[model samples]
Target: MSGPCSRVDHMPSENPFDDRLRVRATEILRELTGHPEASFRDGQFDAIAALVNDDKRVLVVQRTGWGKSAVYFVAARLIREGYGAERGPTLIISPLLALMRDQVAAAERAGVHAATINSSNATEWDSVLDSLTGGDLDVLLISPERLTNPKFRTNVLDVLLDPSRAGVGMIVVDEAHCISDWGHDFRPDYRRIGALLDGLPADLPVLATTATANTRVVTDVAAQLGDNTMVVRGALSRDSLRLGVAPTASAEHRIGWLTQHLGDFQGSGIVYALTVSAAEDTTRALSEAGWNVASYTGRTDAEDRARLEQSLKDNDIKALVATSALGMGFDKPDLGFVVHLGAPSSAVAYYQQVGRAGRATDNADVLLLPGTEDANIWEYFATASMPDEDEAQAVLSALSEADAPLSVPALEPLVGVKRSRLELLLKTLQVDGAVDRVQGGFISTGVPWSYDAERYAAVAEARRREADAMLEYEAGHRCRMRFLAETLDDPHAHDCGRCDVCAGQWWESGVDDSSTSGARRILSGIGVPVEPRGQWPSGMATIGVPLKGKIPVDERVSAGRAVARFTDLGPGQVLRSFLADGAQDAPVPKNIADWCITVLKEWEWEERPTVVVGMPNTTRPVTCADLSRGLAQIGRMTDAGPLSYTRDPGSPDVNSAYRVQNLHGAFNVDPATAEAVDGQVVLLVDTEIGSRWAMTLAGRELRKAGARAVLPFALALRG
Candidate 1:
């Protein structure tokens, strides 16, 4: 609870072998770091000693460059080299592939045989398993998600946990903050770690290390590790970083500033974005401006992510415009700068990201380019990640009623939740004992589960508080580093004397006219392809739609175009304002109408549409009608008028199954329109596309009514 550091009041007194073990650890440290004569940092030796000599559960809270990896590697090496009677492979639960790769390389340098079992290396699992049980592997790394993997749990993990055999000599949890629900980056799979600890041999030493845990996360994780866990927390401040925040009025300005000033940063680093679309947008603008950069996002392939990460470390590119996917387990000792295109939701999250820079460098820059839309993006993610109570109950009920384990696809229609969200909720339920993920899919555990509304609400409130603290951080009312440190309850929080506030804004602010105009010109060209749905939801038959598998090509809508995606950084902001929630229905803005015309002109379709038919617009009828009429008038096409909905389809915001079901029998093409649609390429128009079921169903009706082709177009595509 004290200032710069905190530890257990009483450490096991020195053993006679302590000095010898320290000497050996120092030797391994030097080898691992490739730094001759290298010595252990302040708390590194103590942590290694606690794990190896005393057989203790240790929680190490240190800054990014504090060599926490070295402690574990050294301890594992010592344990395997006969430092104590207990000996086998040390099982390390790491979160990211990048981290595993780096740790394995480091382990090799220390004469420790390390291999990882992750999704990317499935073919090598058998060989890796052989090494693990054959005493040829010193450390084995796996992701927390592997714990629930039925095959992994049975084939490899069971071998590691068999008590009659040597079993695991030690366990290491990296990025341990994720184990706590209160933490900024909590993952449901990490909660299974508590169960892992409980099942491990009581005397087996376990080590949990993180650079981001605050006092709350620390206490929670320590409690999970059991009563006898010893915590070693050190100063959270980094002397190598000079923090700053740059305020921008709009997304364009932020892009412009990066275009103009990113080269001014010391060296290769990251340009962080709040969303995948934003990251891609930034990467495009930078690449067009001739800056060597690539986009990194959740959508990036695993192999591409590895290559890109290495590229950044090699300084082959100036920066990586990335989402939070690049946050943890990335190592670049000489990473020169990190600039956030938008603020993260919490100060702790920001600290962890910025901590990536200045880890092994003398002077690195950390700047936050705050945008006006930061709060909106933060709120969107805040609500998006939380499990909906209704959805959770629906999933549980469906699983309970099912005769067999239900796959995600099978559960989606029954639960009416999207696939990604349903998967997350299932994971949460699995961790909470309400469900079990088996070989085929998931099954209810027959446990009476109660939704913990109070706990979720408390977590939400904590998130809000963190958001407010981030705002305070961006405001620069106090030292940036100190504010983040204090928010994490680091008693040693002090003015870094080098932040924007402390040193009077070290960042170069403002974008020049040429750069701003260039960014605007690049972002202004907006025509994103809207690929038509090729298949119906899997359980459409159960929903009485009688549809399944691939949609008939003759009934399908051709790939169409949207003026812009609502998630786009440039035109998106303007389009979002025009079609925001509760926004009144009005005529299409002239600029947007002109952009739509541009998209139409650029569209090189095999055949031009002869008729424009607007889909029924319950939410924004005026806008949809205006868009259709304007396009018809501009393109000299027939304005066949809007399609009618026989029954209200309700909100289009529901899950895929219900959305498809609602729109199945809803469309009504009048006799006149059906006659007009005969042997003609019909342009199907809509104001916005959310679930996109409306467009698909309407196109099907049009195609059924003898239209040669249905080309679906929308003013905006919603994410």
Candidate 2:
């Protein structure tokens, strides 16, 4: 006690373990029959001893299978010797009762005075509390749930306030990321820990640790610990892991793949599916295929879960088929692989699950089998059972009244819905952009609090827009990966040189590389526009007229020039005509022509209103005939046909011959007609202007007779 504490100026440079403490620790380790020569592992011992010398706590976070438990065990042995009988007891806060029990049992084997306080230890709990209050316990492990109880809080405060006690020396918060809302395995009680720390003495050394802290979660944990806490980050990159993605059509294929792979690997692994049912099914299938597999889900009992986890650790099972619930607290060093049977809704979940593998060493593999129906399932989950305006308002009001995080169990009755249904509603609300889930609960995103009902309605309408957009993209003849990358705003190159898209294995035998290149060029040329232009007979109607010398044709001119005339306006109102370029003194409405030109300048001519002019052959009305031929020629040269042609080809003088073929072929019966044709099946299609127009015209006629599929004319032609 007098060695480092007395020398104020020398504190910084003095050896963490002075001669006396070192002698004491060596004597204690000898008595306990520990590795007497195990002196500290150079740098590791130096770090721990230095922390002890400064009275500053150190947090050592080891992955589940990375020998985390050893950090504490070794530290305890070292501290027992260094401090002798004067050292304060260490407080270890364990999140789970089973974990605490395991730790206490392990300590007892090493002759350490480690005791656990929980509901199960009724008689011993009281004795342990008394002993801790009297400064008799070396280490105490308790769950956070117990801290919520008033009795436990009072007992802890009483011990901290006792003058005879050494006070709480070092506080170790294990699984510290559970306190952060952004963590995958968040616990509401973890949030209350900040308040608990505030009640303790300011100078109390604190150590927080977790094996799974990503960059975000680590920042959150540091903030929760208040100032003066140093964060030590470990490497996130696992070198031994080989990441791979597989494209599969169904769950059957996933099971087959797992079976084939697991057979070859022969080490322990985990296969994660979407739901509990899927986990069970895949487990059974793998079992039938002669693999020793076990299933784990939220519904599994605590005891059974422990047994299964132990079996996995003991290599009694070759594989574990589980939902996302299994790997949080369990650590297996030799876990060789992690397979995702379905697509994760977010990248965060994927990162967390994949992180579970390769924690012990580098020889791990992460396999992701993204089924074709995965996106459909994700969309279904996102859009399922969203709360209506009234229900959302009710939930918001209830949440506003509560001071603490409320679990779904406690919130359901207040919101007047079944628990399962409420969960689905919450998830849908998250997807629909109404609320954000923090920790285990959710908060409104100010969307439902819109002052204008119309604005709120418009925001709500975005859900339909998103669904429509997804349907259009998924149903289109394109590369799925390209579509996904574009939707997600990822910086995907023309070819990732990976993915099904780059490999030419996407929808319908994959997209043609030449066609894709040409399509991209066309889109690039279309460019971003400023105004909307109405479809016309000839490509887009020319706005500017050739400025020729003024030809004052009062009221009588040639039939060609006098096709139509308006003389009621003021003399200053110029007449408008369509010509490429001429003189500036043209008699045609120059003002009106100028206005048209301005409008065209703002619009995207190549996209919606497609601009087309006469092909030098004849001024016989620049019809779609000339436009289509030119476009078709371009397409043939580029090998990229099937271009989208606008409804109006701009020409009003005469109908284009090409329009007869493309227009009729493009027309499709509307939703009403499709509904009438097959009432049992839902037709998910784009609700564009042309499609709606065709539907309105043919709906009644199609339903009146023997219509079969009522499919799009394009699809029908393909069939």
Candidate 3:
């Protein structure tokens, strides 16, 4: 229960390994780093020796870019040669495929034969598996998610567990903090480590390492690691970092600042954002302003991610605008800066991410641009991960009552949980022995499942506390690095005399008027594509909508337009404020209406709309009508008026199937409007686009009544 680095100082001066293995380790390290001067860092030898010589379970909490991978890779190499063992390759349970790719490359460079099995390289899995089991590989890198595979558990893990024939040498769990629910970014797939450990031989010698683990996370991981766990913790402070908080008034100010001053940032680095939307928004704005940047998000393709990561390392790009997806195991030793558009929920998480920069540089700039939505976003993620009692009970009941295992799709509608969330709950329940995932899907274990509401509540409270600590850190009165260090319970948490607070404000918080105006202008110009849904959701028939498969070509609306996406960094923010929750219904502001007109004029459709017809809006009828009338009055087009609702089913936030169902009998064309829209290019206007079904259904009706094309356009859109 002491500080994270409390016992780090107790490591002996003498090397734990004898001269022979020590020398081999140094050789492997040199080869891996491509530097003859590369040597063991502090506590690195102790960790290597503990795993190879002492046969111990070691938990290493070291800073990023501190050669944690070297400890394992070198140890794996030394043991394979120094010891009598000849065959079993070390198995690594890593979280990201990106990390695995990097590790594999490093291993090859180090003359350590390593192969990986992950989702990205499915075509190579069989060959990799053959190499691993055929005693041709030194290290077998596997993703934690793949550990739950029934065949993999039987084929790979079972084969590796044999201590005699193709026996296990060691197991490495990178990003070890994921094993604990108390840790930031806890993953249910990581809990499978405990099960894997239970199945392995006791003396197999396991190593777990992470750059971010506070005292609480350490305790939880140590408990799961079982007895005789030696935590080789190292100091958390990074001397190369010059930290600061910009404390911008809004996301817009942050975007504008980056536009004007990103080139002023020292070198190629990272600009972190809280959400994928935020990252993409920044990427688009910065690129438009001529900053060399690329967006890296969870939704990004793996191939693109690899290319972008290399671009950053080579300094081909000024920065990678990214979410936490870019965190952990990304090694760019000469990275010159790390800027955050929004503060991370936990100081520990922030430190881990910022630590990615300034690792090998003399002085790297680190700045935080805190946002108002940080707390709400933090709370949303924290609460979303916890399995609620009602949801858990529903899942258990559904599985128990079923005669056979139900697939996720079958359980989805039955339990009323989203597919991704449902899978997470199932995994958590599987780990807790409440349910089992078989070949078919999921089935109950017929065991009593206790809902630990208090535990989850405590975790949520801890997350909120972390958020408050982040807010305090951003206030900029205290040394920023020291605040983060202390929040992570670092033993050495004193001021480094390098941050804005310690050396007087080092970052420019104010954005120039010209830059702000330019950013707004560019952002407002970016329009979101409102592509029509070409096919009805499959389950619409079950929902009594009587629609399925590809939508009729004639009934489909043409590609549509929205002035901006709510997730966009520029005009999107302004549009969001106008339609934000609790705002009173009003007409479309003239400024926005003017921009919409600009977008329409700029859109080079094959045929321009000769008429405008508004979707009847229950919540914002005035705004919808105003937008339509404004566009018509400006374009010299005929106003066809609003489409009346025959049956109003107002569940705009439901699933696609239910949304389509709600729209089955929802709209009927007004007699005059129908006549006006018949056999002409019609512009369908709405205040904003949510599900797009309302507009889709209404357009279908108009097209059925013989309109040439229904051009759907909205004032704003959900990103």
Best by lDDT: 1
TM-score of every candidate: 0.76, 0.49, 0.75
Candidate 3 has a TM-score of 0.75
lDDT-wise, the better of 1 and 3 is 1
Ranking by lDDT: 1, 3, 2
Regarding lDDT, does 2 or 3 come out ahead? 3
- Per-candidate Cα lDDT values, in order, are 0.85, 0.48, 0.82
Give the local distance difference test score of model 2.
0.48
Where is model 2 more than 4 Å wrong at Cα? Answer: 1-47, 57-68, 76-88, 96-102, 105-111, 115-137, 150-166, 343-362, 371-414, 420-719
Tell me the TM-score of model 1: 0.76
Give each prediction's root-mean-square deviation over alpha carbons.
9.7, 27.0, 9.5
Q: Judged by TM-score relative to the true structure, which candidate is superior, 1 or 2?
A: 1
For model 2 the local lDDT of residue 154 reads 71
Among the numbered candidates, top TM-score falls to 1
